[model samples]
Structures are given as structure tokens and as C-alpha cells.
Target: MSTFFFSSSKAPSSVSSFPSFSTHSSSSPIHTFSESMMEGRIENAKPIITKWNLNSSSYTKAISVFGHNRKEAKELLKSVKDLFQAMHFLVSENSPSHKLVLAQTLMQIAMERLEHEFYQILSKHCDQLNPKSVSGQSSDESRNSDNKEASEDEDELKRAGKTITEEENVSQLAMSDLKAIAECMISSGYGKECIKIYKLIRKSIVDEGLHQLRIEQFKASRIQKMNWEVLEYMIKNWLSAVKIAVKTLFSGEKVLCDHVLSASDTIRESCFSHITEEGAMNLFRFPEFIAKGKKSQEKIFRQMELYEALTDLWPEIELIFNYDSTSAIKLQALSSQQKLGDSIQTILYEFESRIRKDLSKTPTIGGGIHPLTESAMCFICSLGDHSEILSEIFAEHPPRNSTITETNIGSSTSNHSSASPASVHLAWLIFVLLCKLDRKAEPCRKDLSLSYLFLANNLNFIIEKVRTSHLKDLFGEEWMSMHNKKLKQYALNYETVAWTKVFSSLPEKSSSPIPPDAAKECFRRFHAAFEEAYMKQTSWNVPDGKLRDELKISIAKKLVPAYREFFDTYIMMVNGDRNLEVLVRFGPAGLENYLSDLFLGTHILLSSSSSLSCSSSLGCIIR
Candidate 1:
């Protein structure tokens, strides 16, 4: 059996005017139909809806009729002026399964309609607020021309039956609709979708006005019930954006250092502007914000976290300041230590300038020290820690005798007390480092003559550099005096150790040389000793002329007298001056000249055999 129901209205000519109809077949039970019966049933249902009444029997009948026929159900729903009216009616009377089906259908339709409306509005606003168009077309003529061009383009697009490109059709969403959609998605647990909607609308949103309104609201709410979560979210997002921007700007095959620095400056300005203006009161009331009745301490820590984030770029800055092989190449003309020192100085100066500039802008409220200052100080102070290397270079070639004996050497010590702690500390470090260098080179000193001479040269160079540079103010007269004492001691040790053998060959007292064998042996020893000393000491260099002369005089004093006594006793034994040729290997004047040439780094010139006669009995006469 089949039955039909109709409302109390004229039926369309396309349909039969029957108020109710029924069909019965052999396989079906008998069915009855009447206009009055249908009208009565509808009338009974009318009161249920009109009075906002509901019953299980009425709901069952409605679902049985409409649930099977979606087309009729939709038509009935469309006849209502308000969609919610039908929804309310259905929700109150429909079965749970029917309600679920109805809700899903409604939501699907709503989403489709909302999406169409959203895009339509977005396209309209986007065209009107086109930043590129606005920027490009300044005058009215240009604007009209652009509008005409756009119209022509649109007509051409329509003729071609092609949609506009996404690049040409940028979106600018209506905030109200955007917010509504976001709210709907949030309520439905579509958090990611809500965020997407907000992101799309962000460009169209009036940032300045919205920011002002939000700040005002935040301030008001904070006074009554603070929302630390919201504040923290805001701060974190801002810091994260800054970090991302910096990393993006600085990261590439060819990093733009100037751009990175400019971006850093911009971030610094923006952050401080917010804190000094919008966030000042809140920051000042940090204690209150973290109090029991207020927000968490995390709220107060946000600014500090931002500070740490900003200053954390120290590692990158350190890299910039680093003296790498590239820098060494640039400064290759400079000596090794000079290259290192210059690099350090350049980094220190740049870092100091940047740090001071940055810290100057930072608010010192609550006695907070800017991390920039602390970081810069640590970096500069660290340079002094390389004193070991500096000392080695400085002491590599000490001053000659002229430099150490300068009349002004003692006058400079008074100024050392006024030296800055940094300079003084560095100087002290250099001193210790030089001492260490000397110790490391001590193994070479086992060859007393050569090594002591090397020490003397190095010590002299060190003293000269200190006296000439700022080091003089750090290492005073006492330091100079001590090193000078070492220099003299080295000179003395060379003479003592090297000449012991020569001196040992001579007897303490001269015995009469009546024995020809003893005389011949003594002369042989004398000639060998004198010649060897002259040859060896000539090759060894002592840069100071005066020091060389002094050393020569000292050697002559020891050797001249002993040789004269031996010669006087030996010459009387040999006849016809045959012994004279043997006894005098070098004249006294020649010996003095040889002594003078001890550190000249030149070959000694010997007189002819005939000129080898002793001018003084104790003097050298070399063959």
C-alpha cells in the first residue's frame, strides 16, 4: 500500500489534486485514504510544533514519513523562514538516530555555503585592498587605467573560460566571518583549522588598531584577573619570530653580515619599545605579577628569556670576531705575534662598541645588568689569557746591551703603579710565559758558550721591547734589574765555563823553563788553547758592541798575565831565539785584538811568523 499527504493549499497543475491516496495489491494488506483523515493528523501535529510540545508518538510518525524521503524533508524545511526553527522542531521531537542524521546533513550544507561566502567576500576585499595595485597606482589616472586593464583582463578570462590565477587573486578575509569560522572550528575541536583561518586573515587584519585594542584589554583584565598564559604565548611567539627571522636572514651560502646586524638592531629597538611603553607597568610590578593572587613567575621571566635569546647570538658574534686562517692571511705581512695581537685588538674594539651601544638602550630598571656587557667583558679579558704566546714572541729577541743600559731605564718604573689592571695582569702573564719559554729552551744551554750567548741575545731583546712599549709601565725597574742581572750572569758563566780548560793548562806559579821538554809541552798547550778559543768565540754572536768589548777585556785580563810569566821563564832556556818562535804564538796586541773579536762573527787575521815575537812576555803569539 502507498499513501500521500498534502497541505491545505491548491496543488500545482502538474500533480493530481488528491488530498490523500492509497494503493493496495494482492500481496499487501488493505489500505484506506481520505482527505479528512490526513488533514486531522496534520492538524494534530500542528499543535505539537505551534505550542512547542512534543511526544514520542508524534516524533515516530514524522520520522516514518520524512526520514525515508529526503527530498520532501528538504522541501518542508525550506518553507520555513528560519532554519533554526525547523532544527528546533526536529531536535525536540525526532529520534536520536534521526537527529544525528539531520545534524550531519545540516552541518554539511552549512559548511558548503559558508565556504562559498567566505571566498566570495575574501576575493572582493582582496581586490579592493590590493597592496601591489595601491602601491603601483598613485594618481587617479593611473588607478583608472589599472582598473580598466583589470576589467579587460577579467573579460578576457571570462571569454577564455579560465579562472584567475591564485597569485592575481590574493585573499583578504572579513574578520567577523574569519572569527566566526575560527570559533566554530575551535568548538568542534578542529584547532589546526582554526589556526589556519586566523593565519589567512592576519594580513587583512588592521594590526595597529587591533594591537592597541588588545593591549588595552590586556591591561584592564590584568588589573582584575591576569591571564599569564596569554601574555606568555604572546611573548613566546614574538621571540620565536625574531629568532626565525635572524636565522633566516643570516643563513645562506653567502651570509650578509650587515643585514644580520641591521636586523638585530631592529629587533632590539622593537623589543625595548614594547617593554618601555606597553609593558613598562607590568615589568615594574614584577613582584605583584608573580604573587599568590596574580600570574606565575613565568610571566616575569618572559622578558629575561627574550634577553637571553637576543644575547645568545654571542657565539655567532664570536665567530665573526674570530681570527681564522683567512684573517691570518690578511695580516700575513705582520709578524706572528703582531698578527695575533692585532686580531684580538680588532675584535675587542668592535665588540666593545657594539656591546656599549646595545647596553645603552637596555633598561636598567631593577638593577638588571645587560648580558651584552658581561659577555663582551668576558671576551676581551680572555685575550689576556694568551699571555704565554705573547711572552714567547716578545722575549724571542731581547734588547742588546745599549738598550738595557739606557739612562732612562730606571726612570720608567714609577709609571707602572698607575697601569690598568688589565695591562698589569697581561704583563705579569707575559713575564711568567717568558720564563717558561726560557726553561723550554734550556736543553740547548748544555753547550755553555753557544747557549749562554743565545740567552744573552734573547734577554736583551725582551728588555728592549718592554722599555720601549707600554710593557715598561707593567714591568718596572725591579723587573728590568732582575733580568739585567741574569744577562750579566750568563755572560760571566760563558767566560768561566769555556775558558777553564785554557786556564788549567797554565801552572799556578811559573817554574823556570830549564827543562826543554816541559817548555815545549807548555808552548804546545798554549798555542792550541789560544787558537781554539779565538776560533770558537768569533763565530758566536753577541749583538752589543759594548758588551763584546767588555767580555774581551775580561778574557785578556785572565790570559795575558799567565802567558807573560810562562814566556819569561821559558825564553831564557832556549838559545838563538828558536825558543822565542815556539814560546810566543801571538803578540800581546794580537791577543787583545783576537779577544776584541770574540763576538764579531768574523774570522781573525793573524800576523806573519816574523811579527809573532812577543810584545809583552805574557801576551799570545800565534803561528
Candidate 2:
């Protein structure tokens, strides 16, 4: 009784015949009912889909359903694949869909699965069917049996009634669906799967000739919808992946390294795609990752490793060098200094290297971004600020003259002061003063002469004779071109101004218990240079207009009074901490009187800077 009821329930309707069902008899009841009935159902639906032109729309709906629920999507997608396979059977039977619905179905399923094997299979089959490949095969197989087999295979290939190009169009649509699904997987927290899918997408990119497809997708739509949660995950993990890949490269995991490197290159290209030159340089300048809990030494070591890797990235290094030489110096400084005195040693080495070797193989331009001239200048500025401490550091690590050979030539020369730390310090100061004046092109009628002379006497050469054109030539042009510039072209126009600022900023009083001998030398030379340069550079210049002359006279007349004011200020500032030993060592007998004159000179320069553009007034102020 139960069997009869089951048979009745399974029976097809016999009411006005819309379609007829074929029953397959199998030894296994389950296979007959389940596989055959389902397979037959797909076979029957294919023609209906073709007749009704619903293949495209139905497949789209299936995709949407699959996205909402993977299990349901998989089931629906599997059914679609089966349906297409059934259509292949119909094509073999010499009956095919008008739109080749089975072929379209297969294309959709292949796209949905995004299986590499499936792509490989389709590609292989497509290659065989290509006009070029088939042409020769067709000519060789002319027998009736061969003809029938060819006809059947051709029919299966054409089940969609579309040409190879049309089939490819359908396949491309499927490929797009695969991309969408991969993105969905990533969004749904299936990152490993997403990465796998991405790999497949990349392969498809090559196979399908779609360049930057993933990047375009990321830019076009996906990134905008991303919340902080998604963003944080990507940011924190993306570089870890890159680091992991880089680590593999060192560990001999060649294949893994290759894949990671490829991925990293892609990611870097995408990231920098929208960055400006400044922004990119700034990005590299900032330390991206530092090892946690490392002390200074270890931190320095780790940073050196990263710096080496970065420098090896020639393109990035070049960009950094072009964009910010200061940043490059800082990085290079850090790189060279993992060990003791490494930065200074490297600099000395570079200077020696340049002297010893012809630099034909080197880059045409260097130091433009980070010249030794600037670095040396920075040392002077540091001393100018905290001379009491910088003086100590200077003494310990005296500025080195790396020309071991040059020293022997001048060995007997009592100008050993030039090799002294004080001398080197003064040289750097002079260089910096000249550079500042040249760069700013500002007038300096101030108390700069004293400081300039202090540097000049100890530094072995006054401005013109310093072999390196780093400072002298730089300022010389400005001195000559001053007439062409905004200020009156005093021979020492900018040079004077730069020196004034330098002198004003230099340490007048010692922070330590007592001042070093260097400080006294600095003070004495400062005064002499001040008086001479001012009297010489300004006094003999061309005549000024009457108004400028009156201004200069007013300046000169007030110089005595201004000197009084400056002397009083200086006495007060130094009196609080003056060391009698240092004062006496640095002295003209009457410091009070000397201070007054210095201030008077400074006042004249400061005032005349506004009027007498020539050196005549300046010469008097200094004198």
C-alpha cells in the first residue's frame, strides 16, 4: 500500500500535455530517482530557458541569491552547471538552444566558481576550437566517422549559438561575477579565501588581458564603502604580509618570496599611484616600523637594516634624495652610525675618498641635497647655541683633517692652529656666515667684522684663499652683484650682515665653572676682526646721496652712544656669571671701554644698513 502511494506521488501529470517526461530505469532506485530525474530536469529546463530568452536574467538572479547565502548560492550555482552539462547532451543529440543556453550556463558557473582548473579547462578547449588550430585539423579528418564526431563536438561548442567571440563575452561576464564574489569573500572576513581568489583574479588578469582590474575596483567603488574596521585590518596586516614576504626572500623560500614580492610590488604601485613627490618622500622619511622594546643600540641596528633595504630600492632612494636632501642626510647619518662615531668617520672617509679618487663613476650631483659644507655649518650652529657644552664635545672629538698626506706637507707650518678644534670650529663658523649672507642677500653693517676676523685668523685663509669654493665664491658673487640686488652693493654687504647674526648668537659667557682658552681666543679675535673689517670694508666705498650721507653721519654720531648702551647690556649679562680668569684671558685691559666701542660699531652697522648701501660708512663703524 505504501509503495503504491509513493509511485502515484512520483507519477507525472497527464492533464492536457504541456510536455512529456522520459523515465529512466536503473538498478539503483536512488540513482534513478535522484541523479537521472535531476539531470533530466536540467535537460528539460535548458530548452525552455532558450525559448524564453531568460538565461542571462536567471543567472544574474542566481548570483544575487548566492551572495546572500553561500550554501544556497553554491546549490543554485551547482544546479546551473548541471543544467549546462545537460544542454551539452542535447547539442550532442543534434538539438541545441537558440541562444546556446547550456554554454551560457557553463560560462556563468565557471565565473561563479572562479576555479583555476575550470579556467584551464575552458582555455584548453577554446584553444583547440580556435579557427587557426581547427583549420588544419579539419583538412586532415575527412572520413564520415570523423565528420560525425566533429559535427557533434562543433555542435556542443556552439550550443550557445554564439561565435567564439560571443562565447568569450559570456565568459568575461562570468569572470566579472567571480571578481565580485572574491570581494564579497574578503568583506565577509574570509581573507585567506579572498587572497586565493585574488591570486585567481590576477591569473585571470593575465589571461583575460585586464590590467589593474583589482586596483581599478579598489579605487572605483570598494574603498569608499569601507569603514574604519575594514581599513584598520588592511592597514595593520597589509605591510605585515609584505614584511613576511621580504623575510622569506632572505630565508630562501624562493617561491613564497616571489609571490609576496609580486604582491608587494602591486600594492606599492597602487599605494603610490595617487601620491605626490613630496608626499612620497615624506612617507619614506618617517620610520614605518620600529622594533618594540629595543634599547637605543638595538634600535639603531634594526633601523640600519631597514635603511639598507630602502637604499637598495634605487628608485625610492632617488626620489627621497631629490625631494629632501636633509631627510636623506638624516637617514644616511642613522645608517652610517650603528657603530661608534660612524657618521663622522663616514664623512671624513668620503672627503678623503673624493681627494684620492676621480669621481667619474659617481652620480653627477651629490651633496646638493646634503653637502659636507652644510653639515660642517650645522656643527658651527650647534656650537654657537650651546658653546659651553659643544666646546667640550669639540675638544674630545676634534674636527679631523682627513688629508693625512696634506698634513705632512704643512707639518712644519706653525699654523697648527688650523688643525686645532678651535680653528676648525672657527672655519665652519666663517663658512656658515658667508653662506647665510649669500643665501639671504641681506646687508650687514652690524658688529659682524669682529666675528668674521676671529674666524679668519684661526681658519688660515680669509675668504678668497679657502681652496673649496663652498663659501668664498658663493658670497663673492653676491658681494659683486650687490649693486644689482635690492641693497646697495657694498663689497661686503651680505657678508657683513651674516657675520652680525653669527656674532650675536655666539656664546658670550661660559656655562661651565670656568671658560676654556678657546673662548678667550674667540673673544679677542672677534674684537680685532670687528674693528678691521668694518673700517676697511665700509670707509672707502663710493659716495652716497646727501640724504644717505646725513643718515650715515647720524649713525656714526650715535655709535658712541649706542656702544655705551651695548657695553652696559653686555657687562650686565656677563657680570652675573663672568669668570675673572676668562675675562682677563680674553681682554683688552678696559672691557667696559671695548664693549662701548663694539656696541657703537654695531649700532652704526645696524642703522646704516638702512641708508648707506656703500662700504664707506661701514668702514668707519668697524674702525
Candidate 3:
């Protein structure tokens, strides 16, 4: 007695034909009739048996058919449904054949049905899902609205019994069926399809504007379920994709460096150009702004925030591009290096140039400082932590001679010999600004004293800035001290070198009175020196009143006593021999008055004969 499971070309047969249920002895008529009736029912259902076999190839063919031939898939689905119902009634629940066929057929039907439903939904919503379909409207809004419409259409289809609702479709899938489908797809090397399916589902949910909400729900569910392995796998894949994209984007160091430099230029121009007097005041005077009002201050603060954002962005880019590598290593592994130093230098140079240009347009006041000075100082201070890196880049550039060096004015050796590269670079930037200011003052050269005064004021401003801010630390305490000393020395140099010549006309303090010819010659020389010094030094300026006063007093110390003694002695000789009034050109009072006119940036010299007359009288005093 054998049971038969129908194959594609075979008719269904009974579970086990009653082996000639013996009508002899104990065979009950009721059982015999029941067995015969069951066989008859099985045979009747045989003609409607499905033509498809229960195998992987058949399952694959059915799925393909469902995707392209919906009508045929529907007929097949109905047949499979009928077949499942018949088998439940006719075959024993414990039969191995029944169990195998039931499991395989159920999974195949479920997968095919899911694919079919997905395609149907896609077709109906094609216009909404297609990005090209909606040209003018906001895509997200359009897609969301379309998704709602699609869901409503799906519900309508369900009500009409033409399609399954999403909930119903999902309910048809058992855990075992899903596992079987996954295993089959993976074993067949169609694992990527699984990912595609997941992405499609995500896209659909996102288009419906429910992605974020769903993700939150999923996360909450996952915490309770705790499927760590699946979560970890997903995270690993995501991270790997991100890493690949980063590597690709940063593949060329030169390109990356160029992009960074370009970005830096843009940021510098935008931020620096907005630095007006009011903006700068807001930046440096935060407490003042708070006390006053902060509305106008917001824009300035936002621009400042750009610098902070760039600062944060820079380090990450540096790390990824391996910018910390040594120069030798970069040369050897040139393919891997980013040439970060070149980019850094480009940025710094642009910033320096900007500062120079801005400061040129800035107005010079005796006591008040230009806003750029404070802004620039703040910018430099921001870079204080980057000093080591900046210093290295600065060291690579050769130092150029500046105005201080060009004029043969002496600066302290400590300023150059002991200063750090960063400090020197900062000093160079300031000097360039001063040089620009001097160029603007060139027209004032006719009054050379005013030009000099322009230089003095700007230089003094720089010295004070360095001494007061973090620039002092960068440029060093010695550097600041040296700058201050250099300024004083410059003042003294102007006085002694330019003014002393005027006093040189005095005759040597002689034990014997000079001859009349010698005294007359001394007076002539004195007149020339006094006129030259007065004309030259008066045009040159010392803008600071205190400084101007100090310079005048210094000139007086050198010339007053000498002129007085020469006058007293010469007056006696001239009084005895010649007219003392004719020889004595100027007395201590007149000389002191002349010295007082120095550094006022004025042209206070008397006419040549007037100057000579003034000198000739003093000429007798020496005699």
C-alpha cells in the first residue's frame, strides 16, 4: 500500500488504496465505503492539479512570470492556493511528502506574490515616483502628496478585491518563509538583491515622509528585541561606504590643497572686508557691546564665527591628508603627501597682503589708533596656538630687507638674531604697512620733516601694539624692548646727525682769541650750518608733542652752553678789537628759539642774509 504525491505530469492518487479491503470475515461496510469515497474525491481533484513542479527552477520561473505576466501569475496563484487547500484535506498531516511540498510551495507563492504586489504598486505610482515627472514643484512635497494618493488607491484596490493591502501582504509571510527566501537568494549569490530590496523599502518610506519617524520606531523596537548582530552588520557597511567616499574625494593631495587654498582666500576676503571701524570695535569691545546693544554686533560676530569654523575644519583636513608628516618624508612618499606647507604659506601671505593694503587706507591720528591695528592684532593672537606650524612655514621664505634696514638705521641685534620665525614674520608684516604709509607721505617730502613724522607715528603705533598684546609673546619681550629702543635711537640720530652740523660752525674753544679773519670765517660757516639745519629739520616731523619737546631739549643741551661760552668769549674780543654787534650773529636766546622750531614739520628758517646776520653776531662771541 503506497501513497502518491502528484508530480507535474501525473494525476493525484489516494494516500494508500485500501488493499482489497477484504469483504471476507471482519471488513465493515461503513469503513469500506468511506475509503472508496476518499479515493473518489482525491481522483476528482486530480484534473485541477497544478502543472508546475515544486522545485527551485519552477519557483524562479513563476517569479519571473509574476513580474512580467500578471494575468498568468494570477492563474498560477489561484492554482497553488487550491492545491494547498486540497493537500490539507487529502494528505496526512504527518506525511513527509506533504510537509516538504507544503513548505516549498508556500515560500515560492509568498515571494512571487510579494514581487507582484511591489510591481503593481510601482506601476500605479510611476508618475509620482519618477523624479522627472514633477519639474516645477518641490519634489519632496510632491512625492509626499503622491505617496498619500498611492496609499489611498491601494486601499481602494483592496476593497475591490483586486489587490492586497500592505498589511495583508506582510501577514501572508511567516518567519520560516522569509528565512527560506533569504537562504535561497544568498546561496544563489543574489545577496545584493537583498540590499536592493531594503533600499527600495527605505526609499518608499522616505518618499512618504515617514522615514525619520519609522527609524525612531525601529530603534525603539530594536532596543527591546536586541538584534545586535544585524545592527552591527548594517553599521559596518555604512562606515565602509563613508570611508571609500572620503578616500576618493581626497585622492589627489594637490587638488585637495588647491581647494583648501581657494576656500581660505574666499574666507579671508569676505571676513576682512567687513572689518569696519564699528565692526572692529564690536569684536574687540565685547563687554562694551554687551553694555550697549548687540543687534549690529551680531553680523560682526557671525563673520568671526567663520574663522572659528575654518579653524575646526582645518585640523580635520590636516589629519586626513596626513599634513603632519615631515618634509623629508613628504618628498620620499611624494605620492602620499599633501604639500600642506604650500597651502599654509599661501593663506598667510594673502592675509599679510590684506593687512598691508587695509592699513594703507587707514587714517593716522596722534593718539587714537586705527581699527585695523586692533583687528589685525586679534587675528594674529588667534594664530598664537599655531605658532609652531606657522614658524616652520615662515622659515622657508627668505627674509627681505625693510625700511629700517634700507635707511641704515640701527635695530637691536636681539630683534633679528633671537626672534622666532613667527615673530619676525609678524614684524615684517607691520613694517610693510609702515612702508606703504611712507609711500603715501611721499608728496609731503618737500616738508621732509612731515614725512619723517608720518613714519614716526606709524612706527610708534606698531611698537605699542606689540608691547600690549599677545604679539609681545610671539615677537618676544626682547623684540618689543628693542623696537622701543630703536625708536629713541632714531630720534637721537636725527638730532645729532642733522642738527649738530649747525653747531659745528662754532670756533674751537681757543685759549687765545681768534684773529678777525678767522672769526669772520667762523661766522660765515656758522650761518650756512644754521640755515641748512633749520630748513631741513623743521620740515621733518616728530608728531608726538612730548617726543617733539624731548628732541628740542636734547638739541638745546648740545648747543646752548657751547654757544653761550663762545658768545661770552668772542664778545669780549670783538668788543676790544672789532664791533661785537657786527660779529655776534645769534645769542643763546636766539639759538634756543631756533632749536625749539625743530620737528614741528614747519619751514621756520629766516632768509639767508638774516640767517647770516644772526650767525655773524655769534661769530664775534666766539672771537
Highest-TM-score candidate: 3
Residue lDDT tens for model 2, 1-623: 22321132331111121122233234534333343444565655444333222133545322334234434434433444455444334444344344344444533333333332223323333322222212222211311112122234335447533644664534433332333333332222232333443344233423232121111112313433555455445434433432332232111122211222232333322222222223222333323323211123213323334434443453433332332323453354233323222333234334334433422222112101113334444433332333333333345445554322222222212134434443344444443434433332222223343233222222222222332443332223432232222222332332444345325423444455324444444444545554454444343221223323432443345333443334333432343334433332222223223323322222223122221111433221111
lDDT of 3 by residue, 61-161 (tens): 34444335534434444444344343433343233443434433443433333333333333343223322212233322322222122244336445634
lDDT per residue (tens digit) for residues 1-623 in model 1: 01111111211111121112233353432124233333333333332233211122444323322224423322322322123333333333332434334433333333322333333344345323333322222223221231122245345445433443444332211222232333332233232322333234322332332343332223333544646666566555545543433343212101211111122333222322222222222221222222223322223234334434434543542333233322332122123223323333333334434433442332222112224323433332343343333333234323111222223333233244443434433443334334443453455555666656665655565565566655654556766787788778977877887798788776667343346767667667767787787777776666656566777788889887777677656654442345565455664455666677677666664444643434455433444
lDDT of each: 0.41, 0.33, 0.43
What C-alpha lDDT, on a 0 to 100 scale, does residue 483 get in candidate 2? 20
Question: Which structure among the candidates has the greatest lDDT?
Answer: 3
Query: Once superposed on the true structure, which residue ranges of model 3 sit more than 4 Å away at CA?
Result: 1-341, 347-421, 424-465, 481-493, 510-524, 543-550, 568-586, 607-623
Better of 1 and 2 by TM-score: 1
Q: Evaluate model 3: give its lDDT.
A: 0.43
Instruction: State each candidate's clash count.
Output: 14, 15, 15
Error of 3 at 46 (Å): 28
Lowest summed lDDT window (length 10), candidate 1: 10-19
Instruction: Return the candidate ranking by TM-score, descending.
Output: 3, 1, 2
TM-score of each: 0.34, 0.23, 0.38
- Once superposed on the true structure, which residue ranges of model 2 sit more than 4 Å away at CA? 1-41, 44-73, 87-596, 599-623
